[model samples]
Target: MNPFNKSTGRVVLGGAGWSRQIVTDPTSKPVLQTILHALSLGIRAFDTSPYYDPSEILLGAAFSDPALTSKYPRSDLLLLTKCGRITANDFDYSPAAIRASVRRSLDRFSTTYLDVVFTHDVEFVSREEALGAVKTLFEMRDEGYIKHVGISGYPPAVLADIAVEIRQKLGKPVDVVQTYCHMNIQNTTLQRSLGRFYGDAGVGIVLNASPICMGLLRKGGVPIGELGDFHPAPRGLREAAAKAADWVEGQGENMASLALRYAVGTFASVDEKGLGVTILGGGSIEEITENVETVKKMLKMEDNSVEALDLRDYSLFDEEAYKKDEPLFKGVRDILGEWIDYTWDSPDAAFLEEREKRKNQEK
Candidate 1:
């Protein structure tokens, strides 16, 4: 199997987060071209959910483009969709609803089957409800309408717990798990916990929170709350973000460079031999182009280290506390003072609670 397949490379590109940009475009030529360009690059994994506005419709449009399918058959690419959260509805994990959603995805994409189908509400659903839905998805897979079965949610603990259940109850490990483990506006301690946890779980994990952290980390004290959930540069995130921005500015490198490097740094440790696809969403062509270049640069960097840098050299860093002054953000003390101060209790921690659990379980 290709490492980049649903099993190995671990990178899953997100589609719905581009709802405002991709879905809103009816006559847009550039966006459609960019999507094709990405497909041409061997980055085949795509992710979408109904909650992302009209992502399903927009993606269908891109896939249905005559120029694209003519060159690359739909079978060449692997597609995954999450169910449970709908635009005007709450999270629903009922077996009937799950089956209907998969059918809708198959019908919308004009594909005969799904490459992978996730419950999307894995974290919120109880053991029994999840098992019930999982049963139906497996049946679909057995029937050849769905090729793989996966789950995704905001929280990793729930993700792990359910993943364990699937393995034990059905004797088959899940094919993929999606969660937010981005570079910027993220909790490092929590990320470490989850990465280590999932690594140990040996289940294929596709990270969705990559560019999200980059967008925030590239900033020098930018606002936090208003950014997209796909781009949440949280309130306190501005504080740490400012320091990183300053450092990049001082290095004479572009913000995009530092952001891309940091986004993939930790989860993609060279030592661990890890890899995953990340969604690089953009509101415009230039933004997408710039991001693509950044990803290229990050790949070309001399340092193969995927772990985040230790800020001890910059004076703003307190390695013991993982806290640094504004200079730590940039490697600028004064600049760090102006950032939005973030707390550990933020919801992001809950996002990676499974990492924490895995650590405890090991102990």
Candidate 2:
């Protein structure tokens, strides 16, 4: 049976944002407490990557804590990590490297197997290399080191095409596919490709990550601290998003909350079978609690409220709040203007050229 086919909840706790805090101090009690808090609140799945430095190590430490193990057993949780892309400009897609990465992740997490492992940021490397890495993951899946295999990147079309190609060549569909910054208020490109992912690619699950577009949709503009010094969005798009954020804030509404509501509500409404998942990030217990509460409220508002509400017993339904924020959502979208649905280039030309230069020297 496909591991993704099991119920993992609609929202996954993203480890990237929270892990950034502990890179210097991996044993930070506050960060570990945040993880425990999320688990206590019923978040069963976690998304992490070795590329995020100490993210894997931090999460491993959290899971190993007696506080977590005593209450939530390994079987009750889902661990999702990635391989291939090592840093902003480094990647290794060789089968040997892929195998080593998975083994290393296992050792770091102190787990017998990972629930899912994605070929991290496939667009950064050549298609052939990405496919080779994915094939290696499948072999590891068979060996029980991984339970599922998939690919993740910026371009939804590229991800869909790769999923189709994998099915054609390997005779099995990818267990899951993750695409970030494409399903938020500004960009809904991922929604358009859902049919292809489900019907054409036969993907078992599709994870829509970065509902806030990696902090691009927030009031403070694009973040440029520990995560990175640059954002992939062009100047015009960034300007438009700034205007949108200002509009939302002027109306006394939080931009990030509105974006999260729109994303969670939209995805939850369309995904009747619950095969779709949204990955959200938070840096503190307050942020995680707020995000989870926002998700709960959105779930309550969904047409299929019963199933979504069943995940948590508490009721967060507030029709009045929803009604008040509905207009703000539309207003922000209008402010986005022509930038809506736009996708910026990933692994931009400069990086591609640099990669080619390195490859040529090897020959």
Candidate 3:
């Protein structure tokens, strides 16, 4: 761990290439204001990607902001980017594309070498494709153009497997692995391996896309993304979300308070070395600031390892993978009205049945 990482603790703010959907939208003004606001807090890490629409451009604007640069030294910060996906719906993992992407990111973000660059989207591609993409990232890392090398994939998928497999071939452990480990679903196999990878391999893991699914567990008929709406639902989907909402809403406090607490605390308590970083997103600077403070409070609470937030990623069917797996939705029972607790004490067969069905499909 470097001085910059230890000082910031284990949290990475919303720079994780997800800025396009939430931050740089038309309605939001003073776009750079959000970045300024986050920097005002103790946040020093920024993850970004050319994949975000005009996001690299917006970050360049923030980096050059006189007031922000004055308050925080430019060299004092860490800026991360990725390659492999550009625009909204495309996948290009060629080595040339990766090089072009990094160079373009430099031009856009107004930064020299990236602090970290991952093989952007590793889930859909095969291991061979991923290795090729990673080869480029490692090349940059070797040139000192990229300080570290990593990969980002969601769910249990290929990235998890590749992270472990690459160790033998690369002769060095991966420096970072960015994945979505949230308050909803548990890739138990992946989670168990992640701690070891971080410990034995000296790999740093970055968590993203939290609070979206968990945020819905608290607020009703509200969407947390850029311009989403929680609307009419099918019997199955509504049943799932509504059941979890029952337990989540009854507490009087929002699930965001509990869920975010669960994420950081869960990883920190059990893993001896602990989760290296978490990158969260929000609607405003206030939202970002609130997230940081909330995480600080949650880490102070109980650290239970069993807490799970699994999301179903049926974008064509629902709110994408961002939905389905939130921990807040665990209150779902069935037509029989049994409470489907995600905890250890639930014995509802209907709840068990539905949960099992989702797992079986992953096979």
Candidate 4:
């Protein structure tokens, strides 16, 4: 299940943030340059999806570039793409559809085999459909079309449970599992549940995305990013995020810098070599550079120092639940208490809500 060797570091370059830009921009030259720059910074893994507009095509063109291909061959890079969820309200998990999706991704990515392929946002579909798509992906892996198979979604519990379900049914474990918004400073759900994933489901690698929690943990903090239109968080949580930013600023530290370092430090290998992987999205060259520099600072910090331990352990959450101390961290945690483990309603929830509305109208 663990395809990567000990030498492979964990920083993955994500293509979602650049999804819009790549599609609207007339030239691929800028994005290509950013990709090349990221590669130079030791980011070997790239994560993209068909749902993210033209991300797959942009990455495909970047890799297909003669200059880039010559510098970093396709074999050296780990290319990961997702399927199933098409739009906010659209998702298709049938085996036939999945097979076709893989074909399209393969064609678009210009690769015969994908290093990893995840069933996107499994939380939105029926459990049967999600597992069915995963089983199909397993078949694809067996057929030599995919090197690894897994699922991606919002709920950490659901992802871990499905991984266990796959093992029970198939007699084998998922090669990798990715869950976002769980490992960041605001939420520590992943740390508590990772043991189940590693021991019960036998997941090889645990991939954490949206380290900044999709811009919720950014400099501006609350009122999150404009991307909230697609997956809007609760109003209370947004206000708490804003408060946390103010608190962080009052402490003479930048919210984003602290957040980035905390995440990278927590997941990163303590030794010189990076042990764990974290997928980071950057729209520009400066953003990518800043992320790399943050890790460098984390790497150089003395292991026993208070700052290092604080960043690594974070102490925001315990095994049982998230802690309510450290003033700033506690203040934000308290505001999010009601929705601590809460995720926004999925498409399935929306369907049920609509059904209820119709029944009420009939009555």
Q: Pick the candidate with the highest TM-score.
A: 2
Q: Score each candidate by Cα lDDT.
A: 0.56, 0.80, 0.56, 0.72
Model 2 / residue 218 / CA error / Å: 0.9
Model 3 misplaced stretches (Cα beyond 4 Å): 1-4, 16-27, 87-89, 181-190, 199-202, 206-218, 221-239, 300-363
Decide which is better by lDDT, 1 or 4.
4
Clashing pairs in 4: 10-277
Candidate 4 local lDDT, residue 173: 87
Task: Report how far off residue 132 is in candidate 2 (Å).
Answer: 1.6
lDDT of 2 by residue, 264-342 (tens): 7667556534545789888688989889877776655235444443344422344455566678778988888898898
lDDT of 4 by residue, 1-363 (tens): 865552245577788766652234423437788888887776778899888767778777888788898888778888899999887667899999899999998987778999999999887777799889998999999999999997888778888888898899878888888888877677767776677788889888888898777777766643322244444577777776677777777877777766766666566532122345678877568888888766555454333355532222222212121111245445545655665555565445676777578669999
Query: Cα RMSD to native, each candidate?
Result: 9.7, 3.2, 11.0, 6.3
lDDT of 1 by residue, 1-363 (tens): 122433223334567445642334433435467667665444466777766656776776777778878998776677878787663224577889988988888887888888878887566546788878888888888998888787776556656767777777877667666665423423332353354435544555555454444345555433222122444455555655565566667767655455454454434443133453455555345655555554443343224355422211111111222222123333432344444223232235554675468669999
How many collisions between residues are there in candidate 4? 1
Candidate 1: regions farther than 4 A off: 1-12, 21-30, 87-89, 182-186, 189-202, 220-234, 242-247, 270-273, 300-363
Where does candidate 4 have its weakest 10-residue lDDT segment?
315-324
Q: Model 2, residue 340: what's the lDDT?
A: 87
* Better by lDDT, candidate 2 or 1: 2
Steric clash count of candidate 3 = 15
